[model samples]
Every structure is written in C-alpha cells, then in structure tokens.
Target: MADTVSPRPLRRRRMAILVAALAAVTALACWGAYRWAEAEARAALTLNGDLRLGLYASSIRNAVGRYDYLPFLLARDHEVLDLLDAPSDLRRDAVNRRLETANAAAGSAALYVVDRSGLALAASNWADPAQSFIGHTYDFRPYFRQAVETGSGRYFGIGVTTGLPGYFLSHAVRQGETLTGVAVVKIDLEPVQRDWAAGGERVLVTDENGIVFLSSHAEWKYRALRPLPGAVTDRLAQTRQYDRSDLPPLGLHDGPLMENGARLVSLPISGPEASRRAFLMQELALPEFGWTIRFLSDLEPVKAEATGAAILTAMGILLLAAATALGWQRRQTLRLQREARVTLERRVEERTAELLTANRILRDAQEELVQAGKLAALGQMSAALAHEINQPLAAIRTFVASTRLLAERGETAMVRDNLAMIGDLAERMALLSGHLKEFARKGPARVEAVPVARAMDRALALLASRLREEEVQVDRSIPPDARVRGDAVRLEQVFVNLLRNAADAMEGSGDRRLTLTATRNAEGWEIRIRDTGTGIAEAHQFQLFDPFFTTKEVGQGLGLGLSLSYGIVRDFGGTLRAENNPEGGACFVVQLPEAQ
Candidate 1:
C-alpha cells in the first residue's frame, strides 16, 4: 500500500547512486596515494643528495689539508738538499739516510734531491740509491721547473722512473734568495685511491691539461682524462659537484620515469668544468682547483613503486564503493534517501577542507623552497670569501709576529716600524672582517666614535703572532696622539683591512718591507700604507674597489675589501685612495676627519 514506484526508475536511481559513490572513493584514494608516493620520493631523493654531497665535501677537505701539509713537511727537511750537494759518494750516503728518514715520516714512495740544473743527485730508496740517479737530468719535470722558477712548491704527476702513479711535491732550496736546488718528495697515489674506494665513490685526479694522474679505479689509472659530457669542469678543476644532466649520458643509468602525471625529476652529476647553465641541476663548486665530482643514481624503482601504489589505491576505492552501494541497498526507502543526501553533503565539506589544507601545505613548501635557495647561495659564496679573507689575515699575522720578536730582542727602532706595519695590516683585516659581517647581516650599521691610532694599534696587535713567523719588516710613523671621531670599531676595521692588504702585497717577495705614515693634513688625519713589492697594474687600478674584483688566485680574494672600506669611510666622513708609488710598489691612503 506504499507509494507505487516503477522498478526501472528505482533500479536506475540505485545504479546512479552507486556509481557516484564509487567515483568519489576512487578519486580520494588516488589523491591520497599520489601524495604519499610524492612524499616518499622527495624524502629519498633528499637523503641521497645529502649523503653524496657530504661525502664529496669530506673528500675535498681531506685533499686540501693533505696538500697544505706538504709544504711544511718539505721545509722541515730542507737540510737534505745541503747534504746532497756534497761529493757524489758522501752525498749518496747522507741522502739515503735522510731519504729513509723522510720516507718513514711522510710515507712517501721516494725522496729525491735534484740539483739546480734538474739533475737527480740523490735518491731515497736504497734499492735505487743516489748512484743510480746521479747526473740523471729531470729538467723536463714540471715540479722541478716550478721549484726553480717559482721558488715555492708545486704538485707534479707520476714520474717516468717508477712508472707508478704519484705526485711530486718539490720545494726550492734557496741560498739567500738564490735558488740553489730543489727537494722532491714522491707521494704515491695508492693510499688516496684506497680512500676513494672505501668511500664507495670513484675519484679521478687530473692535471691542468686533463691528463689523469690518479684514479680510484685501477682500470682508469694513468688514463688521459676527457671532459665528462655536460659536466662542469671549471669548478671541478678545483672541486665541485654536478648532477646527472651536468654529465654526459654515457656512464649513468636513466632515472625513474615519474607516473601519476607529475613532472619527472632527473638527478645530475656535474663535472668539474661545467658552466653556470650546466648547474641547473644540483651543483656545488670547488674554488680551489676547479675540479668537479658528479653523482648519479637510477630512479626506476621509485617510479615502479609509485605506479603500483596508484593501482592499489584505485582497487581499494572500487571495493569501498561496492560496500557503500550495498549499505544503501539494505536501507529502507525513506532512510536511504536521507542517508544519500547526508553522504553527498559530507563529501563536499570534506573535499573543501582537504583543498584548504593542501593550499596551506603548498604555501609552506614554497616558503621553505625560498629559504633553501638563499642558503644554497650563501654556501656557494662562503669558500671564496673565506679564502680571500684568510690571505690578508695570514700576512698580517706574519707582520705582527715579526714586530713582537723585534720588541723582545730589544730592537726598539725595528719594533716601532714593525708595529706601524702591523697596525696597518690589522686595520685592513678589520675592514675585511667588518665587510664580511655586514654582508652576512640582515640589519643596518651601528656607528660610534673610535680613535684612529688606537684602532691601528688594535689591528696590529691582532696580527702580532703571524708577523714574527714571516720575519717581515714593519715601519709605523703615526703619532700616539692621533684620534678620529667615527665608528671606532669600523674605523679600526678599515685600517686593519688596509694594513692586511699591504702585507699581502709583500708576500713571496724576498724584500718584505711595509711602511705606514700617519700625519695631520688640511683635509684630516691621513694614514698612508706602502709596500715594497710588485706594484698593482695601472689597468686594474679602477677595478680594485669593485666587489669580487680580485687579482688573486681562486679562493684568494672576494675583491670586496676596498669597496667595503670605501663605503665605511664615506659614511664616517673619510676618503680612501690607492696609487702606484714611484719607488716600485703600491700605496694606500686613508683620510679621516680629525676628532673635534
């Protein structure tokens, strides 16, 4: 006796409701599965990226530290070169003893003493003693040339003698600034190769000409290296990381093909000499030697996992929809109608909430992405900046230490001059440090009154230890009464930076002399720093104050010191200038308003 209904219409209505429910469930399940897969993939990729980068960085640090230590080791054993200069028979005995001692300490393959003419006079290994190497010419060796010409040290590739892959670290033996001979130490590449193998990564060490001298993989040993296709080789020439795209497709497996209609992610391993565009994928630079390391991995398993998850989600949705349809069929007609309306309303509300949540998450992710980008940029700048700052600092330290030694030895006149140079160097360092701090700061400058001479003194004091080690001469001509009304800290910083620059200018030059003169002029109190070293080029004078305009080698100078100092001086009512002195050197002049 209930309201009569056509069976066909009822059946049609039931089918429509079941279909709608099934579709809704399928869409939700698919979306959830997609999000889950995306999250997992992102996590895995991030982890992989971190692990590879960490390993690369650690390896580079080790290499740099090892190389830096080489010079010190050679300097310590300088007496061996003298021993090799004796009669051939006596030289052989002394040289062998010294070689054995050095070999024991340095774990080197062989230690050889080469004469001024690049003749191997003595050998370390007893099996091939000095007699075997006596009169053997090595003028063709790069390390020998570097030692004779540069009068410093250099790294050379494997030798023709042993036929084993190695590096020759050569130091010049100077007799009062005259190159007497060279001390060559041979370091085998086997240990470093072993290190690379243990790290689960392959490393190929090449020279400037792309000739591979050492490789972790034995098969690649002594191979002539070619650029990896698309790899960034410039930074790699020092140290760097590239992703898959940065490299040629020759050596790597293809990454996972993304399903779920999302964009595919390709990992790039960059080469050492890649370009800026080449770093579109993940890239890091090694500013030291321009070397690059690339990391690549397969992503097929990730794609398969995502695809399977999507299919499983679709099947689960179908089952859920079937259950929903059965529940609807079991209900009374009136109740079924009521429940259907409620279900549709609930689904709409739930969808709206999900959309809102997704929007918020997307916004958060965007912000995080921006911050990450900023940090990455900062990381790239850090190495170059540190290197630039360190050079001046090292120089300043040398000058300061020299001044201290002069003072301790009761050499008042020399001490005074050295202190002045120390002060100047300190000012230069302070300026550099200030600029670095400001560059990294998120705020404005804080100014205060600072005494000029006191600032200079503080700068000198900071470098006291290093100056003594280098035995550089310093001359200060500033009156103790000099003072400047400005941001005391910043004023000192400027002077320190300028002084440090002067000290750096004298590095490696046998005649290390720095002169500082401070006097009251019509404009203000003027301080001039002069160095007796290779003068600046006339062409580069204008660009000296430009940011990142350094004439130094990679990682040596950020070229921001003069620029920052100029800004600071102008802010505090001062002037800074530079010029080539008539006496074969460079001079920097700083003028600050006299304290009222």
Candidate 2:
C-alpha cells in the first residue's frame, strides 16, 4: 500500500515546486523593483535640483553683501559725516558733489542723507532735473526708522524722485555715541534683473514683508506672496514704497515643503520655452535678512531619471528570468536522470516537501502589512513638528526677557544662570524642530535596542511646561531598567505626541490626570498612557490615526500627532493601540518586543 505511487507522480511534484518558486520570484521582482526604482530616481533628481537651487541662493546672499559694501563706506565718509549735524547750501553742495561722484563711480541709483528729524540733507542727483531729492523728508519710511532705531536698515521701494523701484541701504551716521543722521544708498536692481532675465531661469526674491523685490517676470515684480496686513499696506502707501502700484498677490498652487524644509509654489506660465507642464518650485530663506528666494525648475531631468530607472528595472527582470530558467533547466536534467529509479515512497515525500514550501511563502506576505500601514501614517508628521517647536520657542522668549531684565539690573550672577537656562531652552526647541526631519520623515526603516524609561523621561521633560499650564497630575509606574527593540528618539516622539494630545483633551476638565504604567509579559513589554478627559468619540475612533484627521476644532490642530506617533511605533516593530478607558478617558497602549 505504501508503494502505490508511480514515477509520474514524482515528476508532477517536482514540476509544482519549480512553478511555485518561479511565480513567487516573478511577483517579488515586479512589485519590489517598481517602487525601488521610482523612489531612487526621484530622490536623485530632487537632490540635483536642490543643489542647484542652493548654489543660486548663496550667490544672491553674497551679492547683497557685496552691494552693501560701498554704502557702508559712504556711511564712514568724512564729507558725509560733516554734513549730518550742520547742513548749509554750501556744505550740502560739497557733500552732494562728493556723493554724486561716488554714486556714479559705484553705479548706484542715488546716494542721499537724512537727519534725525527726517529732513533730506543731501542727494547724489542734486543737479538732475527730474531725479533730484534734495529737500524731501522720508521720516515716515520704515527704512528711515529702522536705521535710526536699529543702526542699519535694508528696504526695497520705488523712488519718489526717480519713480523707479530699488533697494534702499541705510546706516546710522554717528560721531562717537551721538547719533546724527542716516547715510542712504539706493541700489538699482537692474544688474541682477538683467542677469535673471538672460539666464532663462525663473528666479524670485521676496522681502520680509512678503513682497517680491526681485523677479525675472515683469508681472511678478511688486506682487505679494501673502496678503499684506492693512497696517503694512498703509505704511507702504504712505512711504511711497511702490508709488501708486497696486501690489496684488501672485497666482499659484502652493505645494508641500521641500526636503530642506521650505515652502514653495508653482507659477504656471505659457510660452514656447515653458514646455514643462508645471514647475517644481523651492524656496530658500535668507534668514539673516528675513528674505525668501524661490526658484522654479524644469522637469526634463527628472523625467530622464525616471526613464533610466524603468529601463534598468526591465533589464534586471529579464536577466533574473533568464537565470532562473537556466537553473530550472539544469535541475530538470538532473531530476530526469533519477526519474527511472524514483520509487513510490520518494514520490510521496516530494509532495509533502512542496506543500511545506507553499505555507512558508504565505506567512511572509502577512508580515509586510505592518510596513505598509506605517508608511501610510507617515505623511502627517511635518505639521506636528512645527506645532511642537512653537512651545519651546515661546518658552525661550520668556526666558530671554527674564534674562535681559536681570542683566539690566546688574545682577550678573542671576543673568548668567538665566542665560544657561535660555540656551537649554533653545537646544530643546531645535531638537523638537529636527525630530520630524531626522526621526520619522528621513529615518531609515529599522529597529534597535532602546532604553524605554529614558525615552519616557525625555518626553516628560518636553511637556513639563504644558503639564504645569494645564494643571495636569501625572502618575508614573514605569521601571527604570526596561528596554525594548526600537529607536529611542522616535519612541520619545511617540510619547511626546501622546502626552500633548492628552493635555489638549483635558484642557478644561476639572480632574486632569495622566497615568503612565508599564508591565512585562511573555510576548513583550506594554506601556499605557491613560488620560482623564473626554475619550475619543466612537465615530472618530477608527480614523484617529489617519493622516489629516482630527477631532479638534479648526485652527486648534492639524490632526497629525496620533498618526505620526502610530507610524513611529509601528516602524519599530511594535503595536500602538488606542481605546476608550473604562475609567472615562482615552488610553493608548504601546507594545514593544523586549531587547535580546
């Protein structure tokens, strides 16, 4: 009875095993390579474009510096210095002649001076019929006030005399400690504008007030990026900055932040040269001057990169297929040699081996679902990082003001202490700002042995001010020696987000309590964060971890905290469970495998 199987049965089993393995390999090749190829190609293209943009931004920053050098020299000029406090027609003429010579030599629009009372002292174009500003008062201008108050100011505006827009560079004219007047130099941006137009590349530079000071496109000049505040608009109009120009906001579709963490927008234009459907835009901030530079890139290079990746993927699949076919052919030859002597018992054994291999393949597919869910949840962490950073920044400002008052009162020792505290606050803010970039958004998918208690401590430290503000009570029972396989910072982010969410939920509740409890079992360690507040609503519970889903009112939240935290935990090979507590609040449980 045991010898009932025939040689034909043995051949069929071998064929079945080969077919299954081939199908599995084929599916893996097609599915995996597509995603890998696309991501790699896109990343490479993006990096290239970003590098190019960074180069141009640096150039503009340096250019601004170079253009201001002569204005700084004019501030220190002996002729201009003498005319500040005492200006007569004879003295003004001498200063004007000297300024005119320098302005022409330096290729500036004009060089002028203003006293503390805002009266125009001298001008480089004093003799020009249509472009002289010899006796106008510009005390109402922001640049005039900024230079008087802060020692230096840079502003862009249309000249009342020349009727042309230009950047005004002003430096305080001070003899010893006594302030006298401001040395003003108007720089005509024509040189930069010409370069931008000739380069055939889209370039835009917006000032601190969000107005476009420089752009290749004529229509975009003097346009605003954001709607100007009414006060700012009135000031601009009163100062004659744009000189009767109606500064409208630019039209565009705003996009997500780039890898470098800058806002951007796509400006659509139609022409023969504008072949790309839409521009890939990026904004680079000139933090020193409170300016933003934006560049729009063509899509041809990225398309080429994508094409190359597809070709490579196809070639790889074909090579793999050929190699696998060769391997099967050789294996078939060897099996055929033994076919003549194959027994009924061996045929039954082959069938059992094939079934076991099939079972193993199915188990692996289920494991990949965890990674899929984590990826789906990762898209919402960007705004969460911005939200977390605000708290630390607000604290830093408080510390700085306190430190300044102590210093002014000659309390040096206390001042030093507060300064150190402020530094700590600043570092904490930076850490919060970078967490999204380093932990979730840019982190490689992996797990590591992490100190569970240390992560909890860090999260608690960040929420210290919030906890005090909300008057929330905390109860902790986590063990100091507990460790798990996960990323420490990311795990800390998970707890920080959870704690903050709990604080928001309990904002006005009378009994605001947060409980942290940890326990270990055969499977792994479990951490529970329970809050005494209104639990998540039944209808919204399922979507709690979905991207852009929030239960809070508009402007209160971006609905990203729980989703980001969920993704972080999942990426660490852990489970993040959310439910309504029996005690009348929300409970989040984090389950992490114990470190080997």
Candidate 3:
C-alpha cells in the first residue's frame, strides 16, 4: 500500500515537471527567434548602405561622361551651320538635310533649327510641319534662355510640346553678337532609362517638380510621382545626400511599405537646372547639371527568409522545452527522496564550485583574445615602422663608412666634411629615437614653450639621414624665434613623422625634393612639408592618418607614425592635414597656436 501511494505521487510530480520544462523551452525558442530577426534586419541595412554608395558613384561617372559629350555635339552642329549667311528656302532645305545627317551621326532623336522666336524652321523629323512655330516665341524655354545668355551650348529638359521625354543640347548660332537661330539636338530618355533599369529593381527618373519623366515600369511613366509609403520614404528624405537638416525626428527604418507592402531602398539623384536642392530617389547623377537618379530595391524576399528562420527557431525551442519537461518528470521521484537529506548550504557550495570553474575559463579566454588583438595590430604596423627606421639606419651606416675611409687617408679637409656628415647622421638618429619614444610614450604629455624653428630643426635632423639616403633635397624656410606653446618632445615628434613621410614619398622619384616652410598666419603658426614624390591617390587621402593603416611593404612600418603624430598635435590644440600639391607630390600642413 505504501509503494502504491508513492507511485501515485510520483506520476503527478512527473507531469508537473514535464509542463515546466515545456514552458521553459518554448520561452527560450521565442527569445532566440526575436534576437535572430533583429540581427537579420541590421545586416540588411548594412548591405543596403554599401550597395547604394557603390552604385551611386558608378552611375554618376557614367552620367558625367554623357553630359560632357553633349557639349561637343552642340559645338559640331553649330560650326556646320554657322557658315551659312542667311536663312533662304534653298539654304533651309540644305539645313534640313544637314540636320538629318547630324541627328544620325550624334545619335540624337531629333535635330532642328529654331529661330529666335522659338519656331522650328527645319527639323530632321518633319512629321508635324507646322507653320505656327515660325511666329511662335520660345524665349521662355530653358535651352533658348541658356543659349541667349551663354552665347554657346546649353542643356534643357523636356517640355509639353516636345511630346517626347528627353534632354536637348542647344547652341546659339550668333553672327557677330546678333542671334540668328538655335541649333538643337534631342536625346531620347529611353536608352538611359533602359540602362539604369537593367538591375532587378524599380527605377524612376523625375524632373524638379516630382514629375515622373521616365521609369522602368510603364505604369509610372508620365505619372505624377508620390512619396513611397512607410519609414523608407522618411529614411530617404533624412539621408545627408538628400536632406540637409541634422536628422529626421523619427529617424530611419527598414521594412515593407504599409501601402503596397513592397521592400525597397530609395536613393535621391540631385542635378543642376533642377531646384538648387532637388532630391532624386534614384542611383545616378549629373554633377554638371545637378540632376539626381533614384534606385529602389524590393525587400520582400529577404523578409520571407527572415520570417521562415524565426518560425523554425521558435519550433526548435518548443521541442527542446518538451524534451526537458519529459526528463524532469523522470527524475522527480528520485529528486524528492534526496531532497529530505539535502541542505541549502550544500547546494550553494556546489553552485559556487561550478561558477568558479566557469569564471576561470572565461578569464583565460578573454586574455587570449586581448593578446590576439595586440598581435594583429602589431602585424599591420611592422612593415611601415621598419621602412621608417631603415632609412635613418642606412644613412648612419653610410656616414660611418665615409668617416672611416677619410680617417685612413689622413686628408684633413675630407675628414672634416666626413665628420660633418657623421654629425648630421647622429642628429637624425636622435630625431628618430625621439619619434619612437613619443609613439611609445603614454599618459599625459608635459607641455612647455618651444621655439617653432627648433622643433622643425629637430624633425629635419631626424629625417636628414633618410633624406640623404633617398637623394631628396630639403629646403627649409623657417624663421628664427618662431616659437609656439607646446610640448617640445611632442612637437618634434610631429615634425619627424611629417618629414619622414615626405622622405618615404620621394624614395624612387627622379625629382626628389622636399620643401619645408613655416609662416605666421592669422590663427598661429603653420608648418608645411611639401615633397616631390609620388602623390597620394584621392582614395587613400582620408585613410592616411588612420591607426595601423599602412601603404608600406611588410616589416617596414606599422602605419602608426602619422596617426600617432596626428594625435600628439591635436593634444596640443593643433591641426594636421594632407593635400596634393599643385606642382607635384603631397603636402602635409601642421598648424599650432602661437606660444605666449
């Protein structure tokens, strides 16, 4: 009878344990699903940003190329017809023939001659030969106004009478400041729209007033454009490229639209002739014209995938909870029997031991991760630093060899020259050592009044060996007593970094010269290090001062020289910038506050 009573309680306890386990597993699954969904959304946003920037750049380049060519066409057509004195019936007939030839040659849809009154006198396509155009005035048209103003070529958008959506290339045919007629070439919008719509995304080309001039979807063509519904429209409007205001109040969001439920990304194209600040929701631009192209991508498929993953994760968690509940029920009776002898202190001790073991493992893992990060950073900088130090080291070796040879010869004059070289080399060595010391120097820097010329001298001294080794001539134009308030050591470090960088830049060049100039500006003192070395590519200018980013060979530098130098200058309330010099090579400018 006791055994039977125990079995009954055991069965009830097992059922209770099963229910609890199922609930826990279900909750865990739901949590995991939520986290995964959030991550997927973040990843999608990142991908969108990268793709938008790349495509936008490519499209802008293409548009600029096309726009530049349009001017050439206008010039060519104007030259061909400018030889004619006056508009005669026979001459008009010849002009019509030439217009057809020019249109075909220029790949333009229509070529025509319009009088000052905006009447079409001759056209390649004479489909609608209207006598009314001869007296009709087009002085209000953009192309007409531009031609009259500039006395050359201009671009104009489509108008109501044109019937076709396109841009016009027009040039004023002037006979000694007297405007005779306008030579116009029309470029149909279909080709550009077709090219832009090649990717599997909706594309819209619009005018300044949000009029849909061209679109991949025919339904949208000629339609009055409306803002896409949902947070995406707001995101597009809030982008720095479009909206100039700080940021939108609601911020940006990613997802399907409430109206059509289509996933999309909107890009704005801004171009000239459009309003000064018109925004395009597309992927292309005409910088000269200030036109923008907008490209939108649908996100439905990605959403579907995310939804499926979330559902699967939830189901898996529910299954895990069910299994846990079953296991818990099986141990309920045994656990209950043991509970009678177990005390809270014993359980606490067991838990404490488990926690201690986990903590030890975690601490070991964290230390390893930190060490790995340091090694990675070191690896990146090794090449740049080696190159930096190698130049001075090589110079020191050369000076030593030269001095030894002079000593053996017993030529006093030659020995003096060699001795001077040795002294210069030693000063450079000191400068380099100072730079290394500054890079490794941590904590707050010691500030003091330092003569600007002295700081420049120290930097020049540090790079002298390298400059000599690379055959780079240095011209210093620093004034005496040019002092500034800063840490002497840190200021020297800044100069050393800049001078070394200039030397490295001129390593393999024929015109290996560096110019160092300092002058007092309105703000304070400005030091310029200009070199005739390989100029920096526009792409790499911004990344030059980033820590551990190097363009040097392996084991030569750590890419930290400039980055460290930049920090040191900034700490003393100074600014450092790099730019491509007009004559050749690159220039680094360091500006500091005047010393009291």
Specify the highest-lDDT model's number: 2
Candidate 2 regions off by >4 Å? Answer: 1-34, 67-78, 175-179, 229-231, 258-265, 272-279, 319-596
lDDT of 1 by residue, 456-574 (tens): 77667655555655676888888877777577656665766776787778787888888888899898788888888788998898888864456776345545678778877888788
- Local accuracy by lDDT, each model: 0.60, 0.72, 0.59
What are the TM-scores, per candidate, against the unseen true structure?
Answer: 0.41, 0.47, 0.40
| Candidate 3 or 1, higher lDDT | 1
The sequence of per-residue lDDT tens digits that candidate 3 reaches over residues 1-596 is: 35346687888898789778767776676667656754554355435533553554454344334434443443344333553345567666655665554444445567666776667677766544542233345566667767767854444344445444556667777667677667666666565456455543455555453445555555455443454455644543432112222222211133343222223333233355422211112245545554555555433333444454555565555445444544555577877635622543464465556556645644453343222111010111223344445655665677677778878888778878767766765665565455444544433556678988887775676556566767788888988867877887567767777877777788788988888888999878998899998888888988899754578863456567888788778988989899999888999998888887
Give residue 289's lDDT in candidate 2 (0 to 100).
70
Per-candidate RMSD, Å: 14.3, 23.8, 19.3
Runs off by more than 4 Å, candidate 3? 1-35, 38-42, 45-73, 76-85, 126-137, 151-162, 174-181, 194-200, 226-290, 322-596
Q: Give the higher-lDDT candidate: 2 or 3.
A: 2
Cα-lDDT of candidate 2: 0.72
Off by over 4 Å in 1: 1-43, 63-78, 83-87, 129-136, 154-156, 198-284, 304-323, 332-596
lDDT of 3: 0.59
